[model samples]
Target chain A: MNISLILQMAADADPERIGLVCDGERWSYRAIQRAAHGAAANIADIGCSHIALLDESSEAAPIALFGAALAGIPYVPLNYRLADTDLAALLQRIAPAYIVGDVERAKRLAPEGGHTFCSRKDFVAAAEAAADTASGEEREGEGIAAQIFTSGTTAAPKAALLRHSNLLGYILGTVEFCSATEDDAQLVCVPPYHIAGISALLSSFYALRRIVLLPAFDPDDWLQLASAERVTNAFVVPTMLARIIERIDEGVQADLSALRAIAYGGGRMPPELIDRALDLFPETNFTNAYGLTETSSTIALLGPEEHRSAHNSSDPAVRARLGSVGRPLPTVELEIRDEEGKSLPAGECGEVYVRGEQVSGEYRGKSALDAEGWFPTRDAGWLDSEGYLFLAGRADDVIVRGGENISPGEIEEVLMSHPAIAEAVAVGVPSTEWGEAVAIAIVIRPGCDRPDDTTLRTLIKDRLRSSRVPERIAVLDEMPYNEMGKLLRRQVRAHFQDN
Target chain B: MKPGTKLKSAVCDTEVMVIRGSDVEVMCGGALMSEDTPAEKSAIDTAFAEGTLIGKRYVDSDGSVELLCVKPGKGSLSIGGASLQLKEAKPLPSSD
Candidate 1:
């Protein structure tokens, strides 16, 4: 069924169970439901066919969220991390019926139309009282829930059209994979507005789990919640995992006994990091979940045991397969295809394609899926003989230095093997000779002096061919990473563009 | 590295009631290096200069936001329409 039904089921099963938590406040299932009802009433009164709201990390997030769903109004969670100009362009693109936020800033920013702005605090206060002007169920609230923009490196942003079904799939699939229970408590470090974070919060509501919202990700607060609240579930990116692991490496200790399952993946994860975590939190169940906004959240997972068994790589094949994305979930049918859209045998690298109830056929204002309805993930890699998927990187991210196609991840993977290298990213920079030249950027371990560019290039050259070695190495005080811990290779590419 | 020090702080939503003459600036998440989506090319334009946030609520790429406080030039910036000033503005207390 849909997300609305899932929430109804959970509310019916346990009305008093804690559904959400923020700061010192906790919203029980009944409380969250009433607040959702309040949101619907407010949406109706405010008169928005489609609304764009900026903040979802607040206590009012869930109410305004489900309220949009109940009101049959499509809502766009504006990406607050974007520069104001880009946001201005995006807001101009959508021209939302009404904008939602606090009053102080709106008057300063959009002084032209002060009346159109709605205070989130006011909506939240009204929702807490459960005022229902509509007063009843509106079953056909089949309107879109969100228009999330994919981070476009090569082109303009494309808004992914996510319906209630798409979001429900993410919630249910995530809940099932984690085996979430009523007693489970969620500590969300990811922003609630992003797909991964929003999905975590929605899944909590469906499972009647307690949720602690963080306005943003902070490792100290993360560890504190895990130790204090016995947080059972988390959604994080590999970089976040890397940072936490680094913290521990620096002699900081955290009691993570409460964590049960964590869903991860914005990009690739270093197997070494996973090995370390398994040792660090043996009690916590870990899953490497793979998905895109096109398919909600997770379409596949490599369970803890799978990680444990496959990690010991004696054979080159097994070692390579250790990097596998694991098997496709029951909800999805995954396939490997060549450039012609023809299916390929196992162990051959090709574009990964997914078809499922969870996968959407098109993006808003654009079509992303093929004629056959398979969402062709531009990621290139092979599915091993045992049906395990290994990702090289995005197909577009593959750098052709001279005639040889080189995956930046391959070079970075080898660079990461150096003990002193804390994080590494390789990107292709334009060259007059090679069409594109390979360049490397690195972040060294704290307190450790970085290797000179010559030594760093020699390090990669020793493991790889001279051609595979980076033409230049730039060591920064820190490797730039996002909230989810993924490396921003595109940003790195821009550095070498003019140089 | 003190464990408790806030690593980064974004100026989310702000009201400009007073502009007392400070260099109005905003620090935003320039997190595109790690993401593969092609649309992230707009980042250069995304970095908000002090002058851009005037009369505009700047939304970022990741959904975390900072309202551009107009630094009227020198003393302390204030909300243009409201009475609040940087001196009068109270920091949102830290939460667990």
Candidate 2:
């Protein structure tokens, strides 16, 4: 069954189950599904494509989404948080039949398409009307379901076209992994448009679980809601989790006893934060999910026990492997390869390649896969002696000193341990002598005097090889990052390159 | 001046006008007694008559219905009644 069918099933199985909760307002599954059908009927009259489009919203958004599925129209939720320009670029790439969200922004940003932008009032009314409709059986698969954008290691953001089947696999796989049942309640803090968000939603939908939605996230509210709603599961970002741990450090109580699972990915979680959360919520299971939009949501997950043991492993080799995103997820294949595309041995560090039911073949705008039918993840990491994966850094982020390769992540991880430094981002700055050298940008902790460039360089030299020593250090208030909290090293380098 | 020239507008009453081919004033302003409109603004009071969700709940752009705790301003919408409220409902950070 496709996504809409899942919603229909949930409505039938437990009509009174609270499917949506926002700001103390709650709506049952039946209420939400009926409203979506009304949205679908109205949308069908305009007739863009049989695809339902949702712009991120706080309330009444999910109903419209479900209504599209009822109409047998594939629904695509666009990420509304991006800058107007980036959003426009993604809108162009999607070129879906219709759209929803900031009507003005959507109109201005997405003008070329033969689509319509329904205003906020009209949409709310549509949902209300649809809510009165009796249960209707939704038809099977039709158009594309969702178009999620992945940041390209190359030029522009690449749009990943996801079919109903794509969503089906992600949702079902996650349910099986987590043993999700009807008893679960998911607090959805991530934006609806991201692949990760969709994955979490689909999994909850399949398990007939209730979803507590948060339009945007604040660390405090997240904790409070977990306690108040007794939310069983949640998805958080590394940055968000780091801040939550910071709160824990400040004597915040772990009121999240009801939370069963906390899944995080997007970027590497600083080891310290994970350790802190494990100690705080000893009963809560932790999952380290790893994937790009290209691979549904996550192609691999390190389970709570395995993850903790890996972190606590005495052997550096064992710990490294455990820290690595655990072995390929069920039905997924992982391989490390050299430049020639020949698969490398288990322990060698090279481009990490994945292939699975969740993996897509091509990028919407460009060819993501090489001539050999494999997409280069552009991430540089080595499979260890134990079949564990340890990511060095992005292959593009690698620092090439003449011919030697250096991982900037290593330097950043080391610098982060310094008492004065709060956050660090290391980039490969262009060089005249060597091809590229490590350049460091540090966000110092409050009350600490700015560490001089010489002092930082000396610090690196004392800890690492001379080659790994950063040539310069610039003090920044905060490292620039995308919404997912992944540092944009390319942007960081560009910001200071002229100087 | 064209509708685009004026960067902002105010709604003086509960209803405003939206030109099919022009900027339409939407439900906005959080829980305030009055809404202002620019000189170029058109009243869309007819939407209240035609709007599907509003007759029962007075949602001002946001799908909020005078809830005690949650408040929102203008909600965003997609084509064909695809809408959602814009809430400042991020979990409030507390001093731990």
Candidate 3:
């Protein structure tokens, strides 16, 4: 089934329910469906094999998303933040594609040719004009629903192909259709290019929840919009959450009592931030969601109850779970495997592998799944006896100092525990003696005095092995993060190299 | 229909995918379910009105036939001659 079926379910169940809210306007489920149908009819006429969006988060994003699904074409959301040359290069890869949003940038990609481009405003206007037009017929046979470009932190981004069935599997396996009440609204700040953004649209629409889109993230704007709309649900990256927490602490009276749930992912969340957030919003539910662009959003979720229990628990094991990403989804099977792909028992760190209907490890024409359907997620992590999953950062991010591998996530977690430090990143730097030595860069919280190097080193030595302690420390005004809020480790390493 | 076949209600907006297929009739609101389509309102039976919900699995007594409710409806589901009961729902935390 196409992903549009999800929206159709909501439209059929309650047409009058608010489906999307953006820029001081709201569209009912029926209205969104009509717009999507209009867009679908328009897209089908173009005969493009792919539909791409080069814009920020907006109503046009969702319209293009469902419309592409209905047209039996893959919906591709490109990073609007990429440099002109790089953006044009990626756009050329998907030739004969219909490009929507940011007509300026879409036109810049015109040199590639074989592309039809339109701004979000024109897309909306055209779709509305074609509202009465029939949207052809339901897509038959198997088809690709979305083609998302993975955020290339270490290497060039690859297009991850997500089939309609894979997206449907995620929707069917996770969300309960039309389950959200009429009063429920989810605040979406993540850009359309992110998998979380796409999944949020699908799951929220399927559950009949109102979506409030933030074009770009600003702490003040996010808080103001959430309060004004009385948003009950939201999803944020770790960096966003840290900023929100910082804003609240700085005399911003945010009446977030309407917020019932807040899910965070896309990067590791420090335990200290979670603790502060819980103390501030005692009644709100917190969830730590872990997934990848290839995995169709979240495959494991640390629930609200687990957060509270871990926060209040006396048991060390239970308390340590505050750092875990929780157990696998009911539909997913997870295992930790060694280098040889042999499964390892609990507490033994290795590469993470997952198998599920939603696990679309296929990138373009290449299939990353093994014969058994298990996709090897190149992440260094382990599961406890109770099935809680812990992350040791990306496998590639491991700091191999003198042939002993060390996970940056472990060292970062320990450094973040320090009261003065608000953000910390650990990286491996060139060392003449050890091949590579641990290096740390931190952003101290406002008004907190920066701890001396010896003081900070003693903190790590007390908690972790002396070998894990940072050989060099740099306190910066802020750490580097991509627009989506993921740490740019390559950039962080560059900082140490220059110093 | 065989297992893994997705079907829509013939009498309501309910949609489901067969998980444990059987050679017996599978009815939604007393009407046989087929592909996704609008079922006649008159076909909705008041006798089997417990209603189906999305993300919930409904199964027969011996677990030979199972269906997951992909779309909710006022109509109930049944397999063979037995009414399909709601399986215990183990809700995973909303991840995204």
Of the candidates shown, which would achieve the greatest TM-score relative to the real structure?
Answer: 3
lDDT comparing candidate 2 with the true structure: 0.63
Tell me the spans in candidate 1 whose CA falls farther than 4 Å from its real position.
A111-115, A130-133, A139-142, A172-180, A246-255, A312-322, A444-469, B1-96
What's the distance in Å from true for residue A447, model 1? 6.9
Task: Name the better of 2 and 3 by DockQ.
Answer: 3
lDDT of each: 0.63, 0.63, 0.86
Off by over 4 Å in 3: A414-422, A431-435, A442-475, B1-57, B61-76
Q: Which candidate leads in DockQ? A: 3
DockQ of each: 0.01, 0.01, 0.46
RMSD of each: 20.9, 17.9, 3.1
lDDT of 3 by residue, A282-364 (tens): 99999999999899988898899999999999999999998999989998999999879999999998889999989999998
State the C-alpha RMSD over the true interface residues for candidate 1, after superposing those residues: 18.9
Ranked by lDDT from best down, the candidates are: 3, 1, 2
Error of 3 at A152 (Å): 0.6
Give a tens-digit lDDT track for model 3, residues B2-96.
75567888878788877666566788988888865753545688877789977678988877787877788888998654689988755565667
Candidate 2: where are CA atoms >4 Å away? A50-61, A69-74, A92-97, A108-113, A127-143, A151-154, A177-183, A248-254, A311-313, A365-367, A370-373, A417-420, A445-466, B1-96
TM-score of each: 0.76, 0.75, 0.90
